[model samples]
Target: MIPDPSAPAPTVRRKPLLAVLLAPLFMALIAVSVINVALTAIGEGLGADSSGLQWVLSGYALAFGVLLVPAGRIGDATGRRRMLIIGIGIFTLGSLLSGLAPNVEVLNISRILQGVGSGLLNPQSVGLIQQHFRGQARARAFAALATTVAVATAVGPVIGGLLIQLLGPELGWRWMFLMNVPIGIAAIIGAFKLIPDDRVRTRTRPDLDPVGAGLLTLAILGIMLPFLERGASVLVWLSLPAGLIVLGLWWAWEQRYKRAGRPPMVDTAIFSQQAFRNGIVIISVYFLGATSIWIIVPLFLQMHLGHTALEASLMGLPSSIAAAFSSQLGGRHVLRLGRKMVIVGFGIAFVGLLCTTILAGFVDAGWVAFWWLAVPLTLMGLSQGLTISPNQTLTLNSVDPRFGGVAGGILQLGQRTGAAVGTAMIPGIIFSLTEGGHSWLEAFTIAMVIIMALTLVAMGVAFADRARETSAPGAL
Candidate 1:
């Protein structure tokens, strides 16, 4: 039977609703995370050098980041479920293409398709939660999402490594991509079955800003491409400046779009909301730290500690599990403590980071003594669990549901931007600092210090954002 078009939006049962909405997101995370572990196999198989391998990763990130706002905006206008199904289909096809790609170059193109699909689908997860749930239910929904993503991030490497070890690199990597086909199909089926039809009646006519969207997309490319490029070249230096220029033009066009009563890619007015601005600062900085450890630690483990991919992945598992638990606890208590939860979450995470950094930097612990790292990582995960859901809840809570898609898109944009920057710069710092007879320990230590600092800044920002205290902490 068809979902009743006239029924209220949140008519579906909550758990099933979340399961359907979050499945694609879970697969997207797995898709990217798994690739990192499989990159070596891919490189050797395709005869790819460093640059080709880098593109395999960067291509997906660039496309995914660039298209997020446009995808979200389109979803908000046309219908989120409609857009999501299309995205899932594209993602599945991308996986098929990736698995089939005989060469590295074709693999890069397939990665872009996967990224685009992710970009299209991710915002809907957040927006739909905002759209369907209210008050305490909303917080719980976000918490569930946070934990699911954390677990997915944590498990991706281990699962990928085992697949490679058991199946052989050539075939294992291909199976990783092929794995998504079944998951994506199931998610599509569940989406049709569980997700309710849009029924809020949009606040305004659906006037999409194609010009603004194009400008925004190009602007992202301008900024992101430079980071993705390696080597010191004139073009490398020019990428950031060129991207900035495009952004300025996009802003100018946005003003015109607003005045003309068209939907700008992101309404400039969203920035005016104090909670939104504060949340942006908090999440972006947090990601700078959060994403860095994930990338750098595995490299450290596999190379410096001389551990296999599976070993490194196992070392990280406790943290993900901790984070999953903490996320639920944070959500359960958010209504009780309100903004203090965010503060406490960051504080806990800060301590965790400090411990992890000291242990890694000073002790120079290796794979044999994995518990030393595991202790701090678990703490860090818990901190993230506490921080992400509450902060996300507070951020989107303030914005009206009409712009929910845009708000979620921008929030995710900030995260992707931070992750991209961390992945590009921090690893480079490790390599650069480690060169010229510097020890890996010293290089990693310095990176850890920098990584710790980002989280510290985020903690400060979260503490400073007192506006959430005054608002309904659990506003419907």
Candidate 2:
């Protein structure tokens, strides 16, 4: 039953609706970071070992990454608000289960369910933004989301530390998950009041490609399983080749399915556009460098520099503040400057990384490290501010708005994949450098080398943005 074309479009008050929609997205970001601080506490409480701890993180990420595309499609077909409410409900329930979990296995299971909730809601936020806003207003909405995510990340450890200190591990860890309860409730209530109910009506049944979903899930698991199990057993090696084969088969199957007039797990056509393709590469590389800092700096400060969690979190303040402000600015300039923002941002970030390497090498005292690290971190934040929001704007703007849900899913998948790889690789780099009785300086140097290499790649892609702009309409 098609809706009447003559019916008037529903009036949606943009600001209030956006605020309501973004609330859940903000809560989701908080959930991710809050757990990072509570990981050790949760592991100890559940009697989990190193592998179990890794599972607690990777399991959620893996589930979240794999399901994002399908969830986005579901929101597009139905109503985004409906999916948001359901997803938030599931997420809140999962958080409760996680807080009450009696064992490592239960906690891990709960984390995966929470990830499912995240996957469902993540794309809906993007879809709703695309549906409701256009041009500058849309850019602002995305910028706000990015800033919220950055701030939440920066505050996570501090909040976790204070909670753990004040309440102790058992109760404190629960608060991390429990914090979502009220936030989620507020989001649900606001969503009902603010979000419009004007969904695209359809009589034809939308075919969900379960086989493709299963294959994609298997492919991601195959790739991620080895990293999660590294240093554990010989089985890790065996999983690698099998995962590669499964992934190859999945890609081929998707192409075949697309030819048969079915919506495959991912839309292959999006990659055909040079701008979209280049945007993905730049995003992956930029995230690789940025995520490495988060993964390595915290561990380095806590283990070698002898700083507490709170202190380390405080040290990250410079970058967080810079990034939040820069993102808004970047959104404003992206339409005018085109891809110049990417080049400028990466250039600044590269210099900051160099300064950071020097500071880490020369500084011995904790206070000295803090002050010196702040300079580079602030640079990084500025660079991030310039790059991320514009990149998102470019990537989304390059695509047809009809495919916004899928595009957002793919973009987010790149981010998670980059983060997982960056997080996994940094520890390996540190471990490898320290093998020959080398000083911490050697490890820091190697990490900086990797970051610089990623920066150069991002710079190269940014330069190529000119060709992409010419080839595509509205690419800037």
TM-score of each: 0.93, 0.93
Report the Cα lDDT for candidate 1.
0.83
Q: Pick the candidate with the highest lDDT.
A: 1
lDDT of 1 by residue, 293-370 (tens): 877887787788777778777877899999899999988887677668888887887787778767775446433475
The global C-alpha lDDT for each of the candidates, from Candidate 1 onward, is 0.83, 0.78
Q: How close is candidate 2 to the true structure, as a TM-score?
A: 0.93
lDDT of 1 at 236: 74
Clashing pairs in 1: none
For model 2, state the Cα shift of residue 409 in Å: 0.4
- RMSD (CA, Å), each prediction: 3.0, 2.5
lDDT of 2: 0.78
Worst lDDT 10-window in candidate 2: 1-10
Clashes of each: 0, 0
